[model samples]
Target: MEVISGGFHAVFPMEDGSRVGEARRHAAQLALDCGLDETEAGRLALVVTELGNNLARHAVRGRLLLSPRPALGEVDVIALDEGPGIANLERSLVDGFSTAGTPGTGLGAVRRLARQFDIHSSVPGGTVVLARVGAGPGPQEGHAICVGAVAIAAPGERVCGDGWAFALQGDVAALLVADGLGHGPDAAEAAAAAIEAFMEDPLASPRVLLAHIHQRLRSTRGAAVMLLQADVASGTVRSAGAGNVMARLVSGTSDRALLSQHGTAGIAVRTPEEQCIAWPEHALLVVSTDGIETRWPPTVLAPLLGRDPTLAAAVLVRDHCRGRDDATVAVLRRKD
Candidate 1:
C-alpha cells in the first residue's frame, strides 16, 4: 500500500494562451521528475497542451491541476472549467468535430495516450477531466481502496497551510486532513507535524491518533486535525477530530456529516471522542479542511460518485473552494 504525505504540488491557472504554453512545459518537467522516460514525458506534454488550449479557448474560468502519484509512478492531470459543456459528448471525440474551427482530436488523443481517463460534464454546469500518464500500473491494481485528493496554497502565498495523508495496514486504512491554525510558514509547520505524528502509527484508533498528533504539535502554532480509520473486514468506520476539519459519508444518494470537537490540536485540546458509523456497501468517505465551503451542495457530487475518487476530489475543490485559504479535499472508496 502507498502512503501519501501532501496533496497536489502545483496548480496552473489557464488564464490565456500564454499560460497554456507555461503549463505544458511545467507538466512535462513534472512527468520527468517522476522518472518517466523522454517518450512518456512527451506524451504528457501533448495531453497538457490539448487540455490547456481547450481551457483558453472555451472556458470562462479554468485551471489545470497537476499532481504526482509517486506510488503509481504516474502524474495526474485534471482539467476543470466553467464553460459551455460539451453538447454532444460522443460526437465531439471524432477527429474532425471541432466547435471552435480547429481539429477536434483533443479529447480523443487524451483518452488514447493516458493510462487512465475519466470525464464528467453537464449542460450548464462545467466539466472535469482526469488523465493519468506514466509507466505505472493502473491505479486499481494491488489496492483494495482508492483515494483521490488535492491541496493548494492560498492565493499570493508561497506555501499551503493544509496537508493530508493516508496509510494502509492490513485490512484497515487510516486517513487524515490537517489545517494549521492560520496561513504561511508557521501554519505549515503545524500541519507538517500533524502528518508526521499520524504516520508513526496509522492503524491506531481515531481518538488515540488524535491525542498523539496533539502532543506532537505542542511546540508549533497548532492545527485543526481530523483522523479516520476504516476497517474493511468489520464494515465499520471510526472518526475523531479537533476543530474545523469536515467529513462526510455518502451512500446511495444520501449523505451524512460527521462531527468534530471544539478545540485546536497542539494548543488546547480535549481528547476528541471517537464516533463510529456503519460503512454502508459502496459508500464513499470524504474529508476536507476549512478552505472548502461548509455548505457546498452534496448533490453536485452525484455524477462523480461512481468515478475516480480523485475526480471527485478535484470537482469538489473546483466548485466549492473559498479560494482565500490553503484548501484540501480527499475521497476514499472501496474498489468495486
Candidate 2:
C-alpha cells in the first residue's frame, strides 16, 4: 500500500462563539489554495460556518481539516471535535433542530450540499464530520504508472512536519506516515529522521525498520510512526502504528482502518503491544500526523477518498486539525 503526500494539511482548534467568519475565511483560503474560483470558495465557506458553529458550541472544541483534491478533482473540508457527544444524530441532522436553542439548517444540510459527507459520532466525545467540494476531473481517470503521488515542501521546512515513505522492493511496497512530537522545526526533524532511516532499507522487516528509526529520531524529537507494506498484485498488506498515526483504506463506499501501534519513538522505547487491522482491496491509503485529533474516533478518511485520495486525505486533515500544530497527511492509491 504505497501512500502519497496529498500536498496540504492543517488542524486548527476554534474557541467558542468565535465568528463563523473566522472559520469561513480559513476554509475558503484552503479552497483558494487548490486554485478554486471565488464563487466556489465562497460556497464552501458557507458550509464550513455551520460545521464550525456546531463544534464551537456543542463540541466546545473544533478542528478544521482542509486539502487540495487533485485526485478527486475537488477540494474538501471536515470539521471535527471531541466535545459533548451528539444525543440524537438523526435529530441533530434535521433542519432547524439544533440543541443550541438557535436555528440551523443542520448537519444534514451540509451533507446535502457537499459532493460527499462522512460522519461518525458518539455521546461525550463529539463527532467527525466531512465535506467535499469537487473542483473538476480528478487525477485517476486514465493514468498509468508504477505509482503516482503529490508532494509538498517549503523552503526551511524542506522537511515537512509530516513524513512518508513508499518504494517497491520486488512485489511489496513500503508505506508509512510519521508525526514528530509537536510542531515547527523540532517536529519536522523528528519526522524526517525516522523517514530517512526507513528509506535506507525499504525492504527490511517492518519491526526492524521501526527499531532503526526509533533510535535515530530520539536524538531530534520523538515521533509517531505508522507503517504499511503491500503488493496489490499479490493482494497482501500489513499495517502498524507506533504512536497515533494510522493506516486506513477505502474502497467503494466501505472503509477499513488498520489499528496496530507500537511505541511512539523507535529507540528503546517501551513499544505498545502490536495490534493489526485487516485490509482487502483498499483503493486509497491515508497516513496522518498527530495534528489530526484521536479524540474524534471512527475512521472517515477512506470513504472520502473515492474520487481523489490525495485531495480527500488533505481535506480530512484540514477539517480535523488543531491549527496550533503542524498537520500533514499522505494519500496513496493502491495498485491492486
Number of the top lDDT candidate: 1
Q: Which ten residues in a row have the lowest lDDT in candidate 1?
A: 1-10
lDDT of each: 0.84, 0.61
Summed over model 2, clashes come to: 28
RMSD in Å for candidate 2, one decimal?
A: 8.2
Instruction: Give candidate 2 regions above 4 Å deviation.
Output: 1-4, 69-73, 138-160, 164-174, 179-183, 186-227, 231-233, 238-336
> lDDT by residue for model 1 over 84-119, one digit each (tens)?
788788886667789889888899999889988888
Candidate 1 C-alpha RMSD relative to the actual structure: 1.8
Candidate 2 lDDT over residue span 1-336, tens digit each: 222234433444667666566767767666766676776676687677777777777675676655565434466566767666678778878888866688878587788767666666656655767677755643233222133222333323434566665665445567667777766577777877877788777766666677777788878868888777665555655665687775666666556677755567844466433333444565666666666654443345444444444445444553565545556566665543
In model 2, the worst 10-residue window by lDDT is 141-150
For each of the candidates, give the backbone clash count.
Answer: 0, 28
